[model samples]
Target: MPRFTSRPLAAAVLAGILTPAIIAPHAAAVDYGMDPDVVQNPADTPNRPETSGSGPSMLTQGSSDGTVTEGLINDYRPQTVNPMFPEGRDHLPTADIDMDPEVLARLAEYAKVDGDRIRQINAYSPSMGRTIPLVWIVPQDLSEPRPIVYALGGGDGGQGRDNWITRSDMVDFYSEKNIHVILPMLGAYSYYSDWLEENPDQGGKQMWETFLTHELPGPLEAELGADGTRSLIGMSMSGTTALLYATHQPGFYDSVASLSGCGDTNSWLGRRGVASTIYNGNGTPEMMWGAPNSDYSRYQDAVINAGRLAEQPNLYVYAASGLPGDLDFLGPNAPADDGAWDDRRGPGFYIEAASNLCAHRLKQATDARGIDTVYYDFATTGTHSWDAWNNALREFWPIQARGFGIDGGSVTPGLDGEEAPWVGSSDSSRYTDLFGPSSEIYGGSTAPALSSRLDDPSLSSQSSVPDGSSDSSGSSGSSGSSD
Candidate 1:
């Protein structure tokens, strides 16, 4: 994924906003237009400070006559946590229960650091009529209401295991940021969408849309101290779902980030992506959304429903062109790449290339309609793996910090250094014409490894295609409702 910046000239744009930087569907203002960055606005400033104050540093006299007023001062600092954020994950359809063995083993890896802050929370989603396991991360310092950042993994949605966390440093990084993070252990193979029908093979009615937007947040926010703000981020397969979720509900998530995620899923390539994701999960499209180009299937497309995002002028839209960047091969935090079909590096090249194509289409669609809130991180060079995504989380955080009331100043800007993935320079339109719009595989520098892997006919025939489709430029698909 590219660094989080403007759709084009991302570095220069961020340099301007660091120099600076969501939609709402469900309605009423969530943040009340409160500026969360600065502790105080300081309406007035003097060239120099007086050596001596009137009394114990309580002076607010800027009048020409110099009269001091003590009793009229009101500090806007948070006295207690936001009524929404402090509640913890609230009343549930089911009580918190023991985590699955696999999940527990995963949690064991982080026990030494802040494992105690994480608790296993099992909540029932009546929409799906099943138990959804969630990893609830309560911030260590609850002095103020914190924004809840809901992160979803791509491809099989982690197959019931925490996907990206196990592959990248996401869990560790967010753990120290004092944000309440919720990772749901559901939607394996599904796109985390509310399907029309359950797959007969990998069958289970999935109301992920309702479960996440309606059922899950209410009780969690009520009891967990939500601060009336949320940020939903997704990668790979779930990336499309994340973008769709923002359009699904207005004013719900103030911030939305799609790292190397596709926002257009109505094209032939898009349909294939959905199909392949289901196939890997051992399901079929007939059960999920019926035939391709069906009326119901179009409703699930992100670009088709993007106009809904324009309703939210303040929405933070972040996406990336899945080209190779500094973090891919040399990433210090990513798991080792063995160059196998399943390894993060090898297939990631083409998969991310596909996502890169999908991203450009969405960028044009959003731009054509004047949807300017988008921050498209078009990496000049990245793979479609955890390494790119982990960097994206850190990069997107600072931009979101000010709005979410966290001090964005604490998050450092990623420079040209290899370690800094958030480097400002970004553009989303890199490969829209590379080897024709129909081609999804383009090797920037990561081509060698992919070529070597594909050289072996045995491995080449056995490798599971990443998106299972080309990241082509055909924007035509079934019509959808943006509302």
Candidate 2:
């Protein structure tokens, strides 16, 4: 056998392929720009507009103050108030679909030790041509279909699965109640919307709204033992997504809950914060909904669409101040040490404060529209961490169970659960004013009469987008309504 030398073989192959004549610069160059057809025009691309620079800078225009001005608040007053959910509309998905087998195989890798009861599956989306990872938890005794709870994660992205299992007792709670909990791992910094443009770094078309609302439900109901009835609960970033989804698709969810959620995205500070978040997450605001002042941004805003949220049968919104509460120091969920507390305090403080401001803004919009379907909880002492969210989840379970039309009495540990050790004590007194009779923090008592145009049966099943509309580049006559 002949002895083979690796270096000499590689050198011979490279030397043969890469000659000096080929590598040398050519004196003559061809100008492809001269041929119009040779170079594809950037403007001709679908839904993509090529601009000179990165459109606009949100940093210069963003507000540092957490609160919106009185003028800005007044600007949102509606010229014509419309009913959110018209009667006789088909709220459920009409199509029958199945998950791709290859996608299912990929999702099976996320399964934990208890693979049968708890398995992570990738839900396929035809619109996006990709699969999103989702952790599914079902009770072993599944003789019949169970009501579904769609739990969305916050800014940290898809951590809701881990959080629901470890940071909170939701697994035990849902297991005992025989409920189906779906936790979607939507990746970090995804605001859970259909992005205006594809993210180059993330490398996928994020059609989250279409996936959740139109695609996932049909398969879930047929194969995953899920009933038609559903509820939505989200924290932080997803809190806003949950609110938008419930409002955008009327009658889809029986109840909706937001924990430490930012609800106002149209305000100067709100828009700024959203822009900043997108930028930090390796994305651009232009890719999300166009410029800060574009119609896409306005339509997606929860505060701008408060009238839609008011139509839901039940709504729960909760937020907290950055201040350390009694539970922060004393509960089983409390920080392990001072260093842990300190580590969480900085971001937690700002996020909680911002969420409080957003909650107030959302309340203002709902109250102005005479929408009264919200249960508000503005804790006086807490942060944006999981501890506050876990507490809110425990407290909101009764309301969630009621929305599912099931007897809430069967929920584990009752209201006396160890998750909330300070439920009835003075330690919880700080949030009393929010739920009191004279609470100005909630919405109005009466709903306004619906306009004829809004009550038209023909328009009930119509899509959220208006007729004769185009993309979000402001080229169309009018920006269509978001569904």
Candidate 3:
């Protein structure tokens, strides 16, 4: 990952008046249209007091005849808890079941013969603390190691774990497809980043990037027989993390699918944004990047990274959004026709702005690289919410399944070689290419570790290779996500 060099906090391009960022299917639907003027200078000024007389603190204004009238005031309070943040994963009570031991036994027994069932597994993140609150459902019928699909809530409207998966149709979909499903407990505001600056100890508790790419996989391999056949499919923020993970750690996952994911970290924070207070004081893009306007390093806009991964043909990409009415949480009660503005109580408030730009740039970049790309533009009336994501997920599954070398017909190579694996960055400064080397953390493992472990067939022999035959890009996979 190249360090961010600029600091004029990249402003979010809004959809329209009274609307949030949005990526609708229709060309006339106005996926996202922002007034460039809305962007602000990050260094302009800190939140200074602009006071008027109206009682003790309220900002009031003197009318034409010196009459005092209460007027709008600008008092920026620190955002301690993000509304988009899930309630709490700190000490989330685990199910009474002993998941790890049971899963290992099941894997040992199943390795002999082909079988499938309610395969229970655990997922961990160092920042999420010691307890393993995450559980997965793997179908029994898969012959080889299937693609891993990670689902969660947090970005835009999909935050909080309690209702995130249950509220939608994903659990059923996973069961139907037999795709290895990873369900993490990301509530609304947790961007799933290892927040180094937010902790009092600066312990990097939020270092989920390390856990997912390293710690969690070992257990999955021990239990469910995961041999690098992985894919992350999620909504909103988790969706963005899916792409960032693919970009930062190439060769880890064969494909990445994002439904209504954000394009840049700065989009979440308004212009002149605060790092710690809003993102839980875990070091804003500036702090994470070690300079001003450094959001790119953390979130890693897909537009920039995809170009770097151009050679990696196995890197499949998919993005989609729902029609207008389909996006409403409660159907008609939530109207889809809100212009791009901050109508907090209204539907499509925040997600609209971010996902629109993200999907657009992601598609543009992938398409330019001649990477096999799939973009579904559903039409109807909807907003930026789970309902929309659910719809989008259903539409996206076919593409995702194909990426796993499942849905698509046997992928025969063309006479001309398909895309090759992306090599590390040519620029020494930006060494963290999609599958390149990087600094280590949390005792994380590298692609080399995965390769070395492949020598033994402790897992299924079929699990060694990714699905059907494919080309190798010789890329080294690592871990990371935008805070």
Candidate 4:
């Protein structure tokens, strides 16, 4: 009967005095909904796709030479043989590890009932000065060593142990299809790039490239019992890094995936505003690249450099956004506070580099290439959170699976059902070479709450959400990826 004027005080008093027997279970936090309707597994999607709007239209703009650059056309880049590895990485050692009992047990405990096998191990990168911890996931039944798909983490770098191997939507997708997955843990702040400056005795100048491309493959090959031919998939920051590595060393990866990882170091350092953080607080973009404002300065913009990503045989590229229209959380109004420019507010603001201008240029370059690239724009609603990425993992796995010569039908709802829009593949306006025999773009009436997990700027992590809630919408129709 006493006045309960203060909420916090009342909560504390009740919590302290109330025992389990006295307090009732709170129903406010519980969400009760009808059982979800299950559809056919997406991997089993039928091929009878609805075709609309002229089949596979060419996005090619004219060049003076008059050769059509649309469709499957031959493209090339002047290969620069790393003088360091002239004979190739034949000298690199083979990776061998007996899985620790603890890691093995955990892997088995969380073993996806869907027949996914997960392995946790470490690879030392002498160039990067640390042991690159990795988690490898394979389907339980596959005897033959399959092509590896390398997935890079987004934060300062995450421990690959329990990160996603045991529980990622993408890995699950691949595992179900029998594709091998390798997740590596680079230094958190490293952004998978070689430090321009040295870190102790480790190699510095883009040494990650050497470790990933030249050094680790031998051991990985030996461990997997196959030659180290693999694919590259990156999310957010790693996404850009994956593309850079693939473009620099074209033949290593058969396919490339960039999930919410558009733009480059310029975008991260310049527009994303982490330049000084990347350079160890000793350098700014202006100092590192001569003049920050100069377009021709050192370290050319990655988006602009994308034009050079031409010419990889059997190259499959995929770029996607959880939400379109400048990512909502990015750009000038990101933090909405002056304190956002804490470290060095110099020329390396990555947010600036990730601008509409940057986004437009990147789209243009990718589109110019006649590669089979797919730019999925889930612009209706969502954020740059892991939940959105998880859904992307669903959509992306199907797309990537398709690239691996694995064919299937639509797994999610809407695209295959009666209300579906243009099916059987078309080019997104954002990119050129990205194509599919069929594609679905949709929008969600409600953005999933999972995106908020990555809402924290201090700890660059993404959130998780339920599947099929995030929507992808172009101007025409909306679709969901529940499968």
* Top candidate by TM-score: 2
* Shift in Å, residue 222, candidate 1: 1.8
Q: Per-residue lDDT for 1-483 in model 3, tens only?
A: 111011111111111100112111111212111112432211112332233422212211111211112221111111222222235343432222225322222122211111233333334334445333344556545676656766654432221112334345555677666666765432223345544344332222455555666556656555555545667665555666666666665556666666555433322221112222123322334433222223333234443345434433243332222223422434322333444223222324324433443444444334333354333232223445545555545545554565566664332221112332222211211323232221111011111123234334442211112112222222122222211
1-483, model 4: which lDDT tens digit per residue?
A: 000010000000000000000001111111011011221111111332232221112111111112122122111112234434557666655333333312322223332212225555555555544444455676555687666777776533432222344324555577776677766543333446543345331123435656766667766757776434567776555655665665566556766665445443332222223342233312233332333323322123443344345544333232222222232234322333444323113111222223222233343334333222333332233333343345446544544554455564543342223331333222232221122100121121111113233233432111221222222222211111100
Tell me each candidate's TM-score. Answer: 0.63, 0.65, 0.51, 0.52
Candidate 1 residue-wise lDDT, 1-483, digit = tens: 121333221110000000000011122222111122331111111232233322112212211111111121111111112122235233434222223212333233322113466654555666556556566666777887777888775554453222554555555666578778887654555677767777433336777766787677877776677688788877777777777777666557777777666655545445555554555445545566554445555456666455566654234333334344555445653444343223333345555656666665555444434455555565655566555566667666765675576666543323212332533222222233312221112111011122233334432211221223112222211111000
Using lDDT as the measure, name the better of candidate 2 and candidate 3.
2
Reference-based TM-score, model 4: 0.52
True-structure RMSD for candidate 2? 18.8
Q: Which stretches of candidate 2 lie over 4 Å from their true place?
A: 1-113, 159-162, 337-339, 409-483
CA lDDT, every model vs. true structure: 0.47, 0.51, 0.36, 0.36
> Which 10 consecutive positions of candidate 2 have the poorest summed lDDT?
10-19
Alpha carbon deviation, residue 347, candidate 4 (Å) = 20
Which parts of model 4 are misplaced by more than 4 Å?
1-116, 160-167, 200-206, 226-229, 267-301, 313-359, 368-378, 408-483
Candidate 2 lDDT for residue 93: 36
Give the C-alpha lDDT of model 3: 0.36
List per-candidate RMSD values in Å.
23.2, 18.8, 19.3, 21.1
